[model samples]
Target: MSSLRQALSGAGAVLLAVHPTLAQTAETSAPTNASAPPPLLWFLISMLVLVLLVFWLILVALLAWMRPQLRQIYDLPTVHDTWSGRVLGLLVGDARLVKGEVRDELLDHDYDGIHEFDNDLPPWWKYGFVLTAIFAGCYLTYYHVLQNGQLQGAEYAAEMQQAALMVSTTSDDPNQLTTYTALTAPAELSSGKSLFATNCAPCHGANAEGKVGPNLTDEFWLHGGEVNHVYKTIKFGVNGKGMVAWKGKLSGKQILQVSSYILSLQGTKPANAKPPQGEKEAPAKTLAAR
Candidate 1:
């Protein structure tokens, strides 16, 4: 027991000496200057890598899903060797290029998963494009440059004003094929009035007072009162509304004269006239004011 105790005391004395030296060295060492970094940065880097890997996997999956259908509908070609192909290459920015040295091998091309045009662009498409260009050029020159045109602004306005004036000034004259002097010619109206009295008086009364057919000369012609409307009624009579086409019965000239005569009754009053039919015109004075 005493021997065992002596051995223990020696080991304790040795441990005490070593502990002081270790403590002094630890105090001088400055906390090992910094231990190696934590594994957390590695874990973060691993997680980033894992997320990227998962993203790439998803992208690959989507591409795989659509690839088969796209493959059937279209053949994905590598860069080609034609004019359109060159344009596409220009648009895409980097395409396969062939030098003079490579041209021979390129020409000897078998189906290396790419194709090229063996024929030229269609003749119709080429000519059509040329025609379109020419047409565009002509249009630009006419509208933007020369201004000599099918319809110029001043000329069109002048023509319209002239036409409208012609229509209005000689409105009563159906056949303006001659001068306006023919307006007062008796031959023109005598036949029309005669025809109206004979054919139309039986239905409408002698003074064109309404009985069977509506009144005429009473500021109210049944179908219409204007020269054009009257002429139309006489020429192509209404069927359902009891007017009949008179083109065959009366000459076009006779119809025109009758239309003119009806228009002339603008101011003349008839006794016991039927009330005004269609849209009434303003009294001539009001019309003139307008």
Candidate 2:
């Protein structure tokens, strides 16, 4: 018995020592086990599904109980006379609900031995006709009698006037060709000179002599010699050439000033002038005649 007790005590000690290792191993594996969904969540989801199933069953049972009573109510004459009931009846293929009942009493007139029942128009059709008449009366009062709304002609005219105003305000059309004579006033010329020196000097040279661009001091112009032509060239640059469009960079007045300034540089004969490339323009007096 003592030996058996000693053996039992040794086994108990061994179990105590292994308990901590087992607990440590379980702790280490806890994160991996946590990947599975919790039991409580699954239980809650199952309960929700059970509740929905019960509710559906109850609803089905209640509908079954009330179906015969609902059919009886639907068959009543007073129910069939109502609009909603008539709509329902029509859906169920009962035309008598919407269309007036057929009468056995025939009219005096007969065509080709066929007797006429003389039934009234359908209720739905009569209602639609009455609604149309009401709409017509309201429309006449609003547009003609009260004169609160504009007629088609007046509305069209108003829209056209608005369109004209919008068009008048917008003048910067790149495709449109414009014409203007050279500015001769001393102040205007001075402004033009200042604008040209600041903007056109890099390419055309500070003295209007040719550099990377064509000479402005000469009568020869690659585009055109006229002041308006120079303005057009400055506003819309040549695509393949080095000329950059100055439309957004310069205002209309500023562009006109620069053009006038360039024209004034004509016949100045700047030093180291580039040879003329374009056809010579007519004399100023003759050009002005056109």
Candidate 3:
């Protein structure tokens, strides 16, 4: 009893001595664990491995469960007699299965001892031919029988009529001169500036100093110097020259705005301006005075 008590007392003393050290170690490590974030890469890798393992197990179980069905399919006769087998064969275009029974009976016609078997067309081919016939019937009904859709000639004529209407609205006669003065409104000029920057900048330069097109700042005109003349030139661009006709693209009011903006740029000579190409014409002082 006395030895047992001594052993118990010794164990208690050891535990009491180690308790403070263990608590101190745990306290020191707790802050480090709380401060540091867990690594994400290892966690992601482990999760991917777990998912793959689960997928493989599922695949193996499915294959095991379907073993009997796979064996039955493998052992199926080449020429199926059942209705389900015939339907499957039809879908897959299996000759022997779709035909059901072999037609060994030769045709009555024989030439030089060579006989031909009267074999029917494949099921898939027959079905496809029927589908095409149905489509043709529908097409005939829609286009010819009821006349619901327009023919190519009629459609072309309709498009031409719309184009003629557009042309009639804007007079293209070269002799018909406009008396429109240069627009002095700030709003009109701002809209024209934006239009010029988008459409004309590539050829005429950002400041209309001219690159591929003529300089607008100089007192020289390719078509005409007057605002009305400029409007005509812009509306019906030079045919042989690089200028594209803006009649179909821009409205009459838009063309006038752009022409007015071009006139406003006169006498503001920009750097690296191109040499004058057309005849030197005096600026339209009367139009600018408006």
The digit string of per-residue lDDT tens for model 2 on 205-288 reads 899888989888776778887877788889988889899999999998889888877887788899988888787885332345
TM-score of structure candidate 3: 0.40
- Sorted by TM-score, highest first, which candidate order results? 3, 2, 1
What are the per-model C-alpha RMSD values against the true structure?
34.9, 17.5, 17.6
Clash number for each model? 2, 0, 0
Tens-place lDDT digits, model 1, residues 114-227: 754344444456777899999999998997789767557778988877776667435243323221111235787777678777766676656666556775655544554545
Candidate 1 vs candidate 3: which has greater TM-score? Answer: 3
Model 1 CA lDDT for position 256: 71
Residue-level lDDT for 186 in candidate 3: 98
Can you tell me which runs of candidate 2 are displaced by over 4 Å?
A: 1-170, 283-286
Tell me each candidate's TM-score.
0.33, 0.40, 0.40
State the C-alpha lDDT per candidate: 0.60, 0.80, 0.81
Residues 1-290, candidate 3: write the lDDT tens digits.
Answer: 99999999999999999999999999999988886556566788899999999999998798678766654663488535566666545434444544435567789899999998877766667778999999999999998999999889999999977776665443775446777888889999999999899888999999999999989889988888899888888888888899888888899899989988998899888999988878888875454422
For candidate 3, which ten residues in a row score worst on lDDT? 91-100
Q: Which is the winner by lDDT between candidate 1 and candidate 2?
A: 2
